[model samples]
Target: MDNLQLIKSQQSKYDEIIEYLKQDNSYWLDNDIWNVEDKVFGEVEYKISAKNIRFDFIKNEVLKNEVKFYLVYSLKNKYLRLSKVLNEHQFAIKYVVEYVSKCLLNKTSFNEIHIDNNKWKLFLINNGISLNKNNQIHNTTYRGICSEISSFIRDFYDDREETEKDIWYSKNIKGAKIPATGVHGVNGHINFMSIPIYYRNTVKKYFKNIITKKSWNHCHQIISHLNYFFTKFYSNGYTDGFIENLLRNDIENYLYWLGNDYKDKNPTYRCKFVSYVRTFLEYIQMAQYDKAPKKEVSFLIFQDDIPKRELNKDEVKKVKFVPEPILKQLDNNIMDLDRPQYIPIYILLRETGWRGTDILNLRYDNCLDPIWNNKEQKYNYYLCGEITKTGIAELKIPIRDKVAEMVQKSIDKAKDLSTEENNPKKYLFNTYEGKLKGKPLNKQSLLNTIKRLIEQKDIRDVNDELYHFRLHSLRHTRAKEYVEQGMGISIIQQILGHQSLQMTVHYATVTENTLYEKWKNTENLDLFRVNTETSRLEQVDLNSDDGENLIRYEYVKKNLDAVRVPFGVCFKPSKLPCKQQMNHCLTCASFCTTVENIPEYEEEIDHVKKQIEVSERCGRELWAEKNKAYLRLLKATLERVREQKIVHKNGKSREEV
Candidate 1:
């Protein structure tokens, strides 16, 4: 027999099994027929039936206007009993019928469907009946026992019109070209088998040898619980309901139980459960096509009404102090020969206000001069280093005076302990005992040492962890001090190398007491309380170049520069060069005559020149035109003084004071 005859013979046997299932009263019958209305094959009907004993089948119209039938028997039931079967066989039957419909009407191939159906038929023959040499099913010598029944159904029922030849031909051709289902070759199959086996064994070995036995046992217990649930509740003998129930109702209850009951007993259990659930979901995702559920299950929990700790003034003062003896001990220990070389590290933290990580990673090369130093102090050292976690370029911090002195002292001490050819390229805190020799101190080691010191000094009442006392706290304290002293926020930010003002603000703590004290000390009471009616004078333009002015602009400029007057002072020079040149009015013999000659311009010129000179010499850059204008004003005042002197001499010789 050819392929068509064998297919027909197999269909007959499947129909017989369907009849047998229908006759049994214990099994449920569902004659769910899917109908399709097509332009070519009008009213195509596909019928599916399932029984509880593991037998299910589908009947659909074939290409030649004949009814094609297929059946499946579950392997779990040895006696071909359909009642004990799951929904898998029924689902498979539906897939096959749908696949055949697609092939006939949509002109598509169903390779997986075809392979599955073939396996089901083979399974049936191997377990229930036998096939002859010609590949035709035979039951008690009959070639096709259910052929008459199939013919009757086809003749009386199934009134669908035949699909067109072109459509049928396209579908058949497409179906024939379907790809293979299994591994490509023997090597592929071997590799596929070997990889999974190797992975399984390796995982088992790791769990057995590497992980704690208790952990391994716990995982096994969980898996056993899942397996027990699968055997008892799942219709398909799989842990399907366990996952469904976990998603539907148990998750919240489990979290609650963890929070209330197991919160302290097994603090990590809730987190572990969440992790396990995720792992299971991921496994399912890889094995099947289903979405994982999303829910909030936090790992941390705390009492709802917790209060923050705040220190009062006296308590703060007590915490801030280091006893005289303790300070002396620390100083001596820092200078000691046998103790750990942590003095430099501690001093650095106290001085530069750098974090532990920053200090640990500090290079000798980074301690150079700053780009802008108005004081012109050569002892100033700039700290340029990297932030540990972020790995970004941090700002350079300037260390001068006390801080620079401490750093240099530490460097000298470190170098003295080393051999003669000591290079400054070496870390300022290099030692024999620490990691990264010729480099800075280790952050953790430094933290540990400080923590020990704090403990020894009994100062760790609030914060016991030395690591928690960040190196950045030094920076914060310094910033607070600067802010309290009336330093500009921008300057503090530059010193701290903070990119944002907001961050600098966090470190800065302003107090009203400090502000009041500053106000009391610096503000001038006389200036503020002056009576305008008595003290006010006529406003004079300092930019004026009046020649008759007794106070020369040059004299005022020289006096202002000599006194090193602050910006914003007010004064002007004499209009003419005195007979006693370069001499002040207090020492000049011709002072009285000059003063009497140009007394009107004296006060104005004095005030204006002083103001102009001081304004030019302010901390900020001075404009060239402003400086030149002030110089001309001074020269014009000198000329005015000279003209007045000559006029006075021509008029009369006045009496002495």
Candidate 2:
């Protein structure tokens, strides 16, 4: 074979081996590895990923010599085996040097290393490395190249093992003395002697049980809490006891110590620690073959000990919802993001008012419909997904034409690249690039991207506080807008996928600002004066005017609807059965009257007085007795209307209203 054919064969072989290494479950710490590198003596840099490798030497004498002998002894056998594949003539020349100079520098990745049928062979020949076919030193140079790459991989793994504190290392690394600090310790690691060797097996079993349902990241947290709880228990003069032998008081004391030591730590952290210990205890109980004494594990004892987040009555009134103008601007800003993948994500959260987790986990078949109709050539897009948090899947939200097109485009893109099981689509939003590229984008990745942009754009809460825009804020803004539009709480409850109306009310309901603003606008101090003398004022006669007089009734009714109070609407529908009838809503939260509606209230009072006069003038004593109650209620309703109107217009104390 020619020199170029030999080089091409070698390149293909190396590429296959690298691909094998990537697919091998045991070759690397993580099968899915990213770029990792190490610089030796600040001159020669070595970088490697699953698919690519890079070696950059400054060409200085010291560094060149260091690279030449880096790991030659260990790699000599491997290099010799690789060289044996080449023809006798090929082996006589410097094959490794030619490969590195011609292939490595020219190709960005191993897969890209192919004979381009260019001037690479001629260039290698002109470089003037002993081209005499009798040369034996060429083998040594091949071995040197292998040594440098192997040494780089080894150093990378060594650095990762040193930096990464995998929980398994604690249980698996036997006779390799446990460090001074435990798995979670900062200085070194906790000494193995501190935890009784007799109980180590049991502890491992218990840790395994705890981690069975948790993610690797959450498992680390559980491990840390367990480590701290055990260390604390042992330090408190209880080293002789096993985990099961510990009493409730012992556990409580450890928690009390946690409280005292971590006084400044938030309750969520403390609560998590307590929860881990409780789960450990429960596991211990279950492991005892049904004869273990049942121990009551309760958070009630530590309720007061653990700090909680509580809002005052007044504080609860003012919920933090994104203002309309800012949300509109945020929508525009999100659309203008550099990455188009995140645009659909933010818009989905903003428009559908669903949690990010629900949106992230949205699937293809059930949650989305790619094509709405065939004959009409129009789309009837909808969001139909289960809420991850609540497990409620009643979503059937209609999508806007523009948003539907965006989603369809993203779906098409993902489908073109997808190789998921039996379907070209998996996640609605997949990672664009990174170690996780083409996989479903995780919640943290989206959060970090959004937070970075928010900081860059200086997007803030309209209240001027340091209101960090969280992904969930979009959900809140949507809810607030719906409530302001007078949508029913029940409708919103379903939209948010909340199992309970109470949760909907607490999480997505409008704040008191809307009510406060309405009240502020209607304030008039003069309304506070009770003008009893105004009874002598002339009243308009409806019967004496033309049919245009009915406009006054419509005007009064309209104003009644406009005024909203804390109790109920001032006007009661005629069909509703109420003993009080027209005055039923008086003094209720929904009852409201503006200064503009005072005349309406006054007209009702006059009408009621006229009824009483007619009953007495007709000598119908029994009818007059019934009509007196109506007069009294009308007077009471009139007085309330005047008082509320006065308070609303004058900015009087809410207590007075």
The estimated TM-scores of all candidates read: 0.30, 0.46
State the weakest 10-residue window (summed lDDT) of model 2. Answer: 179-188
Query: Model 1: per-residue lDDT, tens digit, 103-187?
Result: 3355221211223334434543654556767576444212222222223233222223212110111112221211111011111
Q: What TM-score would you give candidate 2 relative to the actual structure? A: 0.46
Number of backbone clashes in candidate 2? 22
Poorly placed runs, candidate 2 (over 4 Å): 1-221, 240-242, 279-294, 298-321, 369-382, 386-409, 420-425, 432-434, 441-469, 482-506, 509-512, 518-527, 530-657
lDDT of 2 by residue, 345-448 (tens): 88888788887877876665466665567877887778777553454434777777787777777777767756654333366676545434444666665777
RMSD, every candidate, angstroms: 30.4, 20.5
Taking all chains together, the TM-score of candidate 1 against the true structure is 0.30
